[model samples]
Target: MSLRRTRSFALTVVVCAAVFTTACTVASPGSPSPVASTAPDAALQPFYDQKLSWGPCAPYATTATDRTAFANPKFDCARFEVPLDYTKPDGEKAEIAVLRQKALDQDARIGSLLMNPGGPGASGMSALTSIVSGGIGGGPLAQRFDLIGFDPRGVGASMPKIDCLTDAEQDAEREKTFADPSPAGVAAADANSELYAQRCTERVGTEVLANVGTRDVVRDMDILRAVLGDAKLNYLGYSYGTRIGSAYAEEFPGNVRALVLDGALDPQQSTIDRAVDQNAGFQGAFDAFAAWCSQQQTPCPLGQDPKQATTVFQALVRPLIDNPLPAGPGRVLSFADAQTGVSQALYVSAAYPILFQGIAGLATGDGETLLRLADFYYDRAPDGRYSNTIEAFTVISCVDEERITDRAQVAELNRRADEVAPFRSTGRGPVNSLDPCAFWPVPPTSKPHVPQVSGLPPTLVISVTGDPATPYEAGIDLAKALDGRLLTVEGNQHTAALQGDQCTDEIVTQYFIDLVLPPEGAQCKLA
Candidate 1:
């Protein structure tokens, strides 16, 4: 994904899977949140102290090759069945694939460190395997901790997986309607958005949609906590996962053992408010990319200055608005397509190389590489298959946001985008609006409302100075809200935890190991 493109992507901090908010405390959702039941008073009693046996659980995967997909040998695969609706107690159930890595030092083990991979759709199970084996946590900490990942409800390996558009269909839609953002270029997008929305509603039904909100998923976390026999939930959440962590903290404050919310999302804002913040956030990252491109003009395809590169980049998008590239591999890129492509790329610094390469590809008149980047951005594959995430995103988002309340509002929001983000705003409405959810059977669970958290344990929040997704300010707000500390990296990108920011990593490691927070006003500048 292009850094230019990724920066534009929505920084979904676990509200509706893909991605804002303002104020110290946004209003809470209208419905009462499920209060977390406290652990039994004998939570630390001997009965709860069964020694966890560590070994490879093999039946889940067939062979070494299959297991090779995981990052560590310690990972034991298991399936956990969760209620389709916690409200029903004995409601229909779904199986969640889980990955577990036991601590190397059993005696020194703090507890389970559950990790979330942010895509209300990303495979937590798979990510856990990779991170554990590849030493995601690093050091003795890696050896001493048991890291676990689970596919969220309606996501990877979870039963009754919801997919509205086949991968091929979604790929086609992305290629046809997303690459270009103009009205004349997106007839297919309009049709697909409406059709995809309709199909998802039919496929998942109203009950499932209601069950997939942040509240329910947090409940799923609680269940996992109970089953794991952990007294308090120790968690590390990134992007959308931050919202998950916050919700867990809000609902089960006493259950929080240790928490690390990196690239945190502010849940107090409604969907539109959050989107607006992301729109601005991406623009901020683009501005930084522009500045960098300008300084490296000789090697860069876009102009020397940030403004010039932005102009050139927007011009490239402008032509496609009306005359899009030929659809390939069963998909076409629409305005939204471009937005998704750009948005995903900006979330990580490692994507910069790919972004420059793609820009150079387009500048030199070869669109394949950038197009592939767009496909990846949209989760479309060369074989024409797509991840279920896009569909899940649409289904869950419509049920969680007010952005697509009606068609007229959708149109007006698009207009507003043009005004707010003049260069890219017009496309924002088409790419950022809530069309897919407009026709959703159920209304958004409730507007994003978060209760103030006081007297919480020390927490660490990480944000980039020029993150185009969550915006550094949102991180600032989150840090302030949690009464926690913030470590702002002086660079442009999204999450900083695994981005090779040594200063930032050291601070995070220290927090997790020593529970030491960075001093107030602490900041790390890239050398």
Candidate 2:
């Protein structure tokens, strides 16, 4: 997990709101901003905006004993209500749950540091424990800033659950669909996409999907910033959260005081392009993992050579498409599930041990472990009653990016991926196709907006060279777009801030503490 500057070719690789408001009235494009927008809702926002007693803030204190240790140690819960629809301010309202760990150095507190875990749907509230525990970016800077984790709209605790399918049904459908990218694969892909669309439409109905987008949440963030009394927002966002951060900067660039976007994504790319790029990112990470596994073949199960290991992994994927492994009741891993597992595993090198275990298990007579790995990708729990992120992830994504209106476009992308990454291209299409948004009841109020972060505060953008999720190229692109600083980590994974790289962590800590920017092209060495 150590981070270091690998003087190599930047590791190249593949690869890769909301809001609230006091107003009940709706606004349209070119219309004046809502009057009561800055005001808190008398009904919901008041309570959330109210000062906390600082008592029993950590509702999960009981749950934390069995969990990881906290670095800053304090935890409190607060709820803010936001308009379900930003345009229709008077529409139905929803609550967003927030978790706070007040700065240890209260006298020198530097305002709230909002942390996003980035499922677009990831649970920031749960992520508080990690932040407090110093797992993310070492938590030292946290001593001067209260850490705030809010489950974004449609995510955990925030109400109006976005869950589209029960764990069991989702598993069954996945198993029945998703094959390799052959003729049979096409049929399976179509069936899977149709089933996914049907299931999501049946469960979520149509209205919820349309409302969840990056812009809504960004506005909600502004509301939160206002309620918190901070003149500007200090944010640390990862994965999809980077997209959220970028959108916020675009819409309210003036409000960005200090922002750290790790694992950055370029906002200019369409969803289809993002998917294709992401697939490439994973392919790069997998290639790196394969190389590492080859060097450590004594312990790894795949192979002694990277190419051999990939071949083995590809063979493993093909069979799973034909005969999926069953995990818990009503749960099985499909080709798509397997592909997603590989992608997710590549995001964190720590998952390599688990992937190795799963690969070994599959190579033997058991595929349950690998199947469980797939379960993690789908975010399914043993007892079902899903995490609410899967649904939210889909909804917000669709709102921000237009759907694949032409199936041929998807087909072409898959074909192109096959050219670049023969084994990894198949799943990006149908396996990771759009469902929730296709049937979303509402239309986007605005098109995608990519912000130009010039003349802004000195921002620190971190890109791990081998990051398989948000490609390093994105970090480069974003750093250029933001006209800020970029720190490159020579590692094979996703976000580097939390990975055990002392050098990267030190740079981040210094940036937050000193408010200084790294020189252009500054790189953190791998340990």
Candidate 3:
């Protein structure tokens, strides 16, 4: 029952689900968004007071498959407006779509349990739908919580979504060579970045893109909390979703009834630092995978030495930069797609077999498996329409981090990435380039800093020692920052919670259902 893949895994498998067709609570309570214990300005009152009219959710389904999977009679959809600029509340507004999953036992139901699945840009509605279909309906926790999913500002179903590339354009981007950091390569990469930024700005004006950061999403979250009639928020955030939950806890500690952050991202680390750590983490994960492969009954694909796995993998993929292996109709495996596919499968051990098969196909001059993996990573539908996940991912990331314009620093980041993860290194040298965020139309709304929080209820933070994206230490650091309990799971996966581990599920259920906290230095071995 785990849809445990990368942040932006294909939404077709993780599409929509219905909870309750009844209207959401229309209560409008004062919240401490930034200023503690204060009501929103008078101009923002209408938005805060508006009631949601839940209706047939069929139109909002991401795909026909999603509708079929979420055909429960209780499925309903609704939208609410939040200020485009929280500072200028009376200005234009943005829409947030919500999908609620009702509890099996209404009399014992606690408040809504809001779910956000990573991507910073991933569709919460899609995530909820996937979770419900995975059979959360009959669980003990489901009996007491009305599960809720909402598309954050500038995301799917939300008005004026952050969009950049067209389907054709995205396809071209995937086919690109791993743009090395050579002088000429850097220039080409920068030009591409500049064009991407410009295209994003052109597609969704400067206004919507400007206010789509974690801070803005936090504000919108509070409004949803108010309208949903919850005195406090009970949230489950995985991967990048933890970023939002962390901020929400910091800004409105009093509004938190219970919180769980799995595969937590460290708010204390600068953007580049986190990226460097992530590179090393992925390399370590690849090493683990190779070691496991070596122990298999059959001969390992990377030969006898697990240590040479990186070199072996490079040998298979490097030549593709110049000569892409023919895959299927209208598609060929490129170096970029090769790396993208490999990295995607490394997120969870569950996908390791798929990676093995893809690599085997590459050896036989077949690239279809690897190509499918890359397509899945981008959420490219069979008809070629993309889910806008990457677009929102870029824009939201731009708004969340301090804009870096220094080519030297970019080069240094590349140097570190190459140093830590040699699988992608060119062996020539590290090259420098300007990142797309450097040219973003909107300045960053927030910068990396220690979360300022107090009077915060005890929360839960889960980390995996072998997680590739959000490194294990990031989880430890986040728990330290928030003074919350840390659960260390020994595994090689992005996150571990509510994904069907009896140990993790029991702890999480206890926390959310009864506000219980795991003991200090808690740990669980992945089953």
Candidate 4:
């Protein structure tokens, strides 16, 4: 991805599948539920029955750039109202911001194609703009379907935004020493977690926090489908968005026209298992980066030996634990920051050169480039104001997974993580030393389970073999769970579809245009 594209891509924090079965009967929309009752409450029919008034995309309060971007005439925006709690439909209501780009070929247009760009907290509206403006995959998918994007509850441009800390407070928090695996460190980290949760509850209200899990979001998606007059939903979700897509298929299998889930998240994995898997994945990506760096005779920071590259990289970052390097006038690069910077760059092969330059500078005791990378990961603008990405990410994750409060268990997980990905491990622990969920005000309502969905239209699940965020095994598991066909992209990027990979793009386009399912175990090699 180019720098422009990377910036447009959501800054997802890396805190966070299977096989095929026999084809089941496809259920059409308006048919009896194929799955159990996980849909929106029928009592809230007014909200579902409400009509959308499309107009110019409204400006978000965060930035002028975002405001201007949404003002593009090519995009039409609207707001959808949903209940704060599906269980209490008569209670509070929230507004969901939605955007749409009309299909280029109106005569041959398919229904609206809903898209989500991971983050669980990423702005789908922003993602839509990027896809339409970036000419992604030669815009074949866009030409065939009206692209629909919306912000989930408590996310960007949505009502009741999740706000925990001020920019200044977050800056100070980020600069704090990351806790080691010792008892004292764990205690300190736990205290910070408690403080974070307390602040969030005080700032964002407890009611909204309680309801932002995947289950609620899935319900909201169904409502969107109904309101938009789509008999069946045609959808594409990436990263954390895969969870949303999987849950939708699980709950409303009969309502799917077609779904494509890239960078699949195995719904059945434990929190520790996920963390460990990501650790190993990032380690693999790091090795790939080092090997690539070794071959470059000119701009290569690490010389022509993989082992030496690893040694040098380790030497450069090890000191950050005890003594952080000065990065800028007032900014410093801590061990956590260094780890975050390297991990951010590993998201795409196009970013390897940036990682090389950053690492090379770090080796010479210059931390400027690495700090910039870290800033990008955290979505901290130059002015120091941060987006609510981290805040929303924490709340959604905590509510989706069971809380971890036991110190001993956390320690054990950290030990395994360290062994698996020593270079990427914070040295402090597996969980962010300050495990936010440990002190989450709201307990998780959902547990890890396979989406036992059946009778769905042909869905495509794309998995990148070396994706650090969502591993390949999870994708296989998801495909199996949904009984959907699997398309494997042999690459290290997080999501492969429509990222200029011809094979993956063709498969995805065909699925949307003609409802075609690629052959079982189809593989797309990265260019």
Candidate 1, poorest ten consecutive residues by summed lDDT: 20-29
Which candidate tops TM-score? 3
Candidate 2 has a TM-score of 0.82
Which tens-of-lDDT digit does each residue in 192-298 have in candidate 1? Answer: 66787777768777778777767767767876776676767778777777878888787777677667887667777655556666677776666666666666636
| Model 1, total clashes | 41
TM-score per prediction, in order, is 0.82, 0.82, 0.92, 0.90
Residue-wise lDDT of candidate 3 within 1-527, one digit each (tens)? Answer: 00112482223223211211110111111222322243556877787688988887777766544566456666678899999999888788888998887788989988889989888778888778777766576787788988888898888878867778888999998787635756678778888889989998898889888899999998899889878877788899988889999999988888888889998889989888888888888889889888888888877777779989989988887788789989889988988787777787777776777778788888778998888777767777767888877788888888887677887787788889888988866565765777678888878988888999987878889898998888999999999999888888888878877766678778888888877777776777776
Better of 1 and 3 by TM-score: 3
lDDT of 4 by residue, 1-527 (tens): 00101221222322110000101122222333333233445697788798998888856435443576787888888888998998888889988888888888878777789989877677788677766665551377777788898889898888989889999998888777655666677678778878998999999989999998888998888889878877678898988888899998988887888899998888888877887787787878888998998888765666678767666677778788789999998889987788778888888776777788889888888998888777766767778888787778888888887677776676677787779777755444544354777777777978889878767766889888988778899999999888788888898778887666678877888787777777766888887
Looking at model 4, report the run of 10 residues with the lowest lDDT sum: 15-24
**Root-mean-square deviation per candidate:** 7.3, 9.2, 5.9, 6.2
- Runs in model 3 with CA error above 4 Å? 1-38, 178-180
Q: Summarize candidate 2's per-residue lDDT along 255-364 as a digit string, tens digits.
A: 77777888887766666566667667667788777777767636667777677776677776677656777655656666666666555566666566666766777667
Candidate 1 regions exceeding 4 Å error are 1-37, 40-68, 133-138, 178-191, 297-299, 326-336, 406-408, 420-434
The numbered model that scores best in lDDT is: 3
